[model samples]
Target chain A: MIIDPSIIIIEGLKKIIESGPEFKITRFYQSNSITTNVLLHGIDILLVNPRMSKTSQFTKFIHDCRTENENMVIFALQTSYVPMQMMNLVDGVIEMDDDPSVIISKLRNVSCKTESANLSDNCELSSREKEVLVLVAKGKTNKEIAELLNLSVYTVIAHRKNITAKTNIKSVSGLTIYALLNNLISQTEMN
Target chain B: MNKFTGRNKFIELLNYNPQLILMLPRFGMKLGFGEKRVEDICEMNNVSSFMFLLLCNVYSFDDYMPTENEIKDIDANALVKYLIASHDYYLNHRLKHIEKHIGKIAKEAGKIGDVLLNFFKEYESEIATHFKTEEDTIFPYLLSENKQMIPENIDLDTLSRSHGNIGDKLSDLTNIIIKYLPAEIMPNERIGVWFDIIQLSKDLDKHTIVEEKILMPYIEGVKGGSL
Candidate 1:
């Protein structure tokens, strides 16, 4: 599913995606036309513009979308710049300038990664590590995380390093996306 | 007379470089000084007096050169913190504001808008990724007292190369906006977006230079136990 207000770009992107037989556009929606109910239907992947609507409204839309479909791989269709407001809202970003081949590969990779995260029983994160991961994903600093988790600052740092080593996601944003994909942190909790 | 001496002189420095306002809070200082001299304020905040003077010189006069004693007294950690704050200003505030302007311009451009917007987005992503590397990797390494924890392949030159690429992309976007885009629709808005891009480009260049010339060398000195 692709939801961009620009119909021209939507058509262009759709044409590009349809070039590969493996991918299909489930639905197309203008920014204003999309409602919560439409998002309730099963969607494997959703590509949306962060500025499709006002920031608050779009954030609500994302939250509702996540609530409706927990496993939907949501990628922000970056049109102008990196949307910091949408950073915690989406799983990843897919730039509009990306080649069709790159888009297809990214879609495939995200889909597979999300599926594996959901299905994998061997997620080796300890309970404390999981707690730290959630806080880190929520943008808590090491000191804040220490205070929250009742651990020393060094311990929090160590736990974070271990979490990074285990997940192989270096940055907080990457960890946030990972947490969302794996359902470790829900969209509501993120807010 | 040193320009970084009295409280009034500090206020004058702030007027000269308004962007230095962002650095005040990091030092636990604020505007509207009552009776504090620059050295006194630095002492109150536990910040190095010489380091603050060096910053004032570097920011106020582009051609200013640091004395050996001043260079020796410079704290790399403080510099890293200042750099991180500047990055926050760029990523969180300036870039977000500029993006809103670009959004308006894109809406007005119609079909060609998507192409131009995409070009800008690509550039934005590159810069975000570059900052992420510094924030996640470089800054942490510099802050950490443990030298062994520093990654073996973390070369400053390699990182600086990407900074060049970011500048190039910004220039490309600026050119595209100025030359290729149709001027009939929302010309003022388009020019406003371009102006923001230009400002960002200049700021980024200064930032890169600071990191490459000052911060990187300082870190290398510390790594070698020379600082």
Candidate 2:
């Protein structure tokens, strides 16, 4: 899905992308069409230009899209710099002036990353265990995680030990970086 | 004729390959060479003498490859900026023009079109992210004086490895459209889309080769200088 106000950009992306058969353009809409309900269409990726609107609602729209689908890959297309606050909302950012071929190459890379991450959804961690793993990855001590989850320190420790044994990644920093790359924790949350 | 110095007039070279005009606007030169030698014009326009010569030589002579001596003194930063501008032209102007025609084809194809459209979207997003990495991360690292600012895991080899075959998917799409799709709806329009794909695929392949062979190696040399 493409969500940008520029008819030219939307059309340009559609032509270059559809030229190949690997992906399709489900819908292209102006920013006004972006609502929580649009997520129901099962949009896996959204190319948006958040800078089109100066209102605070633009951020909210991005937040809503993310909330609708946690795994949906969102890319911001901007002519100049994308503000740091706006960067946090999307998976990646592309300069509007970038070569169209370069843009296509990026789509391939992100799709592969997304597919691989989805494949790992079948990993052995239970939902509770995954929760504990995320907290640990976020640099929380056992006691802090225990307080947050309302569990005893021993329980948190056990979960941490189990995560290590299961994943064979014992270092806190390793798990933290893993959580980050895997999208288990947002950069904002880490801060 | 010497590929580099033999071409005395800009108009002479422009006459050979009209497409070289694309570089003219970038160099702040307007059409009409006005009887000036390439060297004199480049100097007067504030364009790098080496760059204008190199570009003319590359574009004009078939099978002409730049020797180490040819590009040794060329400014890597200026070359990169020019490459970025080419990228901008494709993304902002050319691709958008192709897209409008695609939208028409998609609307005409009806319910069955959704599948192809979805695939295109996925491909589009992938390309966008790939460029983003280069523009936001790799390019900055190349241009910056502080090599320490680069992430520990990111080296030239790793970055090069990330340049996957984006062209394959486009080929697949072309095959599907040309060989597989039924000819019920606007067959001419479908063929037009295939042509666009072919053009884009060729352009993308050349672009990647230039980056991998020329640009990345140049940056690597610069990085070695800093270290």
Candidate 3:
């Protein structure tokens, strides 16, 4: 179960995630009216812009949201222009103006870390399986990823099957949700 | 890059209100009222009055995202450059260009241009005055206070009224631009310019809304200790 953030700003951020190669963000919000208790109960990462006035209340909101749901990652939008004193409460602070490519890469890194953390110490995801998972999070189709990863269509299908079994996501879209909640590919990743 | 020193387009585009431009910096007050700084910013940002006129024509999402090379760092220089190249520069330029053409257009289009320009002129002054107050009082005080000092008022009710007026004006200007541009005017050459303008307007609209509804009220609450 992946919970997408409800208080994300930047008008097309959700669209950017959907059109992106790595992941899709199904839920998002731009204000405090989102009722984080209800809206963020199952969300993975809360991509917040501090310049948002309601942002001041966000840390407390996140704290409360996390009391019930501990898996959420709250990433604040940091800007060089903002005084440092203003951004003390977020779990992770990412420069708001950082290039989308850099952001996506960073999200991938976080995602990878979280996914590996879920492993039972064996790192059992075969190299091929992990590669397929990465591509799936990138929002690539089995056929498209097969062409890019240089494997047969049947091999790609097998890898996806193993990934679903390991991740227990039932479907590729659900796997994407799992990837995003676990810090796989962020909505901000798409340029 | 003092290429604009004597040109008609440049002279007419000269700063009638450098104070308005001065408030544009995102962080520090780097570009004061000096001609040299203005010129530097204009050159660095590649801003011109003509570009502002072109920006009024852009309306689509494809026009919002800057080209790859245009995305730069958010440093002091870059911030100033963005204000100049993206916001104030285009705003000042467009206002002036419209001022120049509206008189002529009013004569030809009857009361249409008059109605439109009247709205623009009024809102232009309102926005300019509001921004000036922020520059002279609010922002400077925040920088100096080194601590947040809320304003006298910070409630959502006040914010809603203030923003409603400002937002409506911006919406009117945007609608006019999208509706008025003739189909034939070397539209492609102007495409890039309009894209930047639309983005600037969108960002400005969002920024002002945040400031009035969120930040201003928060500052007020902090100052008054109401929240």
RMSD of each: 23.0, 21.8, 20.1
DockQ (C-alpha based) per candidate is 0.01, 0.01, 0.02
| TM-score of chain B in each prediction | 0.84, 0.77, 0.43
Model 2, residue A58: C-alpha shift (Å) = 57
Two-chain complex of model 2, DockQ on C-alpha atoms against the true structure: 0.01
Real interface contacts reproduced by model 1, as a fraction: 0.00
- Model 3 chain B lDDT-worst window of ten: B54-63
In candidate 1, which residue ranges exceed 4 Å CA deviation? A1-191, B1-8, B25-29, B33-37, B40-47, B148-150
What digit string (tens of lDDT, one per residue) describes model 3 on residues B1-227? 01223232222234432223323343233434344443444455454422222121111121232212222211223322333343454357655665555445444544344544565567668766655555554544444444354444324344334544565455444433343334443344335434544654555654543343334444444455443
Instruction: Tell me how far the alpha carbon of residue B92 in candidate 3 is from the true structure, in angstroms, after superposition.
Output: 3.8
Please tell me which model should have the higher lDDT, number 1 or number 3.
1
Against the hidden reference, what TM-scores do the models get? 0.49, 0.47, 0.32
Residue A36 of model 3 has an lDDT of: 29
Off-target runs (Cα >4 Å) in candidate 2 are A1-191, B1-8, B11-21, B25-29, B32-37, B55-65, B69-71, B146-155, B158-163
lDDT, candidates in the order shown = 0.70, 0.65, 0.47
Top candidate (lDDT): 1
Candidate 1 C-alpha lDDT tens digits along B99-150: 7887787788775555456656666787888888888878788777775445
